[model samples]
Target: MIVKTYQINGMHCMGCVNKVQKAFISHNHISEADVNLKNASVKLQMTNKLQLDELMDVLKNIGDYEMIENESEIHHNKFQLSTYKPLLLVIGFILFVSILSSYKTSFQLMNWMTNFMGGFFIAFSFFKFLDLNGFSNSFATYDIIAKKWKGYGKIYPFIELGLGVAYLLTIHSAITNTICILILTASTIGVIQAVLSKKQIQCACLGTVFNLPMSTVTIIENFTMILMAISSLIFDFFKQIIT
Candidate 1:
């Protein structure tokens, strides 16, 4: 048997490891396959030498997994802005739309913030809704709440959707902002831990569609929402006192 080692990109948790392992072993040529989540590498013992393309083809239906040459390539892939293009594009689009919606006579900070948060949640939740099972599996890997109760992962998309609708409607601002603060704060804590621990995992921010690696970017995304929620809450409080 021939043995080969390859670095894999887009693997974040044991669920990914299991999926990849199954994909390889499903192939007749690959006799044994071992996927290492910690290192994001895979070892295969095959009866015949398998080309990288051929091996990659096996994972086409599974998820956004890619085979790389080495650890350095993994690091290189992680650091490149192109690697995060999808996420950046999504945020940029949301910002544009939010500004457009809020700017009529002049720039309204509160309106813009509300529109931005609404767009952010709706867009992100849409992605999660695309593949709830996939998103849940990925989310449970890093989310503190999802880690404890797998059901939370499944329900998270609905919560985001609800928050988005609430924000868009501009109803019960105090309660909505409070919930947002609590949820995102909890999320940020988990993200901070993951980033500090230097775990090479997938970010479920865009669900399973975009293969985003967990990084400071993920922290910023969560933190920004938390900040917005806090700002909204404070604004509402002062507005209440004034009126």
Candidate 2:
């Protein structure tokens, strides 16, 4: 028997693993199939060397699974721009809209930042709402608070929604920034821990819909929000003093 290892895309949970394994084993040439959800890889013992294209054909009917040659390819793929296109496009669109909203008289830094935050929160929360249970499950794997209380993961999207509305409506700026700072600080802490430990987990920022890997990108995303909140508060403080 020949043994082959391949990296799989779209195997998010044990259920996906089962599906993949079933698909492979059903093929007469593959004798044993081991699917690892954590690393998103599969090892197959086959009677003959199966072509990559042939293996992919087996999975095509089961789901949107793409098989790569090996783990190194998977690692390289992670750093590719296409891997993060969804996230980049989302942030880019938010920034574009925020700038348009703030550019009436001139480029207003405070207004742009506020609008950006509102758009960021609302957009991300919308994805979480798409698959609330999936997002909650993924969040609990790494979030400090979600790890302790599973319900926090379920309610996190709503918290983001509320913050987005508060920012957009320009209601009680002080309280909004304070809450934003506190919440994002907590989130950043969890993200930092996960990145530092090199944990291979899905990022729940865009919810389960986008399968984003937990990395420095997540750290930067959370820190950006926290920095903006702090900056807004500082701007408010100095403005009040000058006035």
Candidate 3:
């Protein structure tokens, strides 16, 4: 069973709550619907998962009420550590390999960070490439540029791939790191907006293949890349200064 929480507007009293509950529970996959007029929230238990669009459609057909999903609530309830096992494992593997590789000559924090980022981008882009159409559809829902230009979503994976190769090859480090910083900074804006607005949406980090919920973790992932890029660039600047 899956539980989804949504903030309901236009509910003035118990009468409105009852109607909303009846409308939702009448749906095929929905087992129960509890609408709390006092809290302005509705909790739904469903046998099958449904997208926000689908839920909106259901409410639209019933009445003029607006159902705004509480993404933060859903993030807390639906997505657990187990739900993110695949993502965690991928990050763990990348960090392990990158750290191991960095130990070859000497331990350099910059090298380790760059290697981790290179592996992160390459592996993530691989999944996005697996089903480009699917990934683009999901990414467009939350990414700033991707939402504005659908083509950006289509080509984002390729961009990631290019960045990964540049990082791995150590080619044009300054330019590549600058590009990384810019792209991730823009991406983080959209992520922040989505989370703050409590929009229930799936994360496009691992592509549409895995149903990862958009939460603080997504924000952290983007910021991690941005931080690494900035750190490397700063280190380079200091090295030049010292010389």
Q: Which candidate number has the best TM-score?
A: 1
Q: List the residue pairs that clash in candidate 1.
A: none
Candidate 3: pairs in clash: none
Whole-model Cα lDDT of every candidate shown, in order: 0.85, 0.85, 0.83
TM-score of 3: 0.72
Q: Provide the lowest-lDDT 10-residue window in model 1.
A: 69-78
Q: Which scores better on lDDT, 1 or 3?
A: 1
The whole-model C-alpha lDDT of candidate 1 against the native structure comes to 0.85
Cα error, residue 203 of model 1, in Å, equals 0.1
46-67 per-residue lDDT for model 3 (tens digits): 5445677787777786568887
User: How well does candidate 2 score on lDDT at residue 84?
Assistant: 74
Q: Model 1: residues >4 Å from true position, as ranges?
A: 1-69
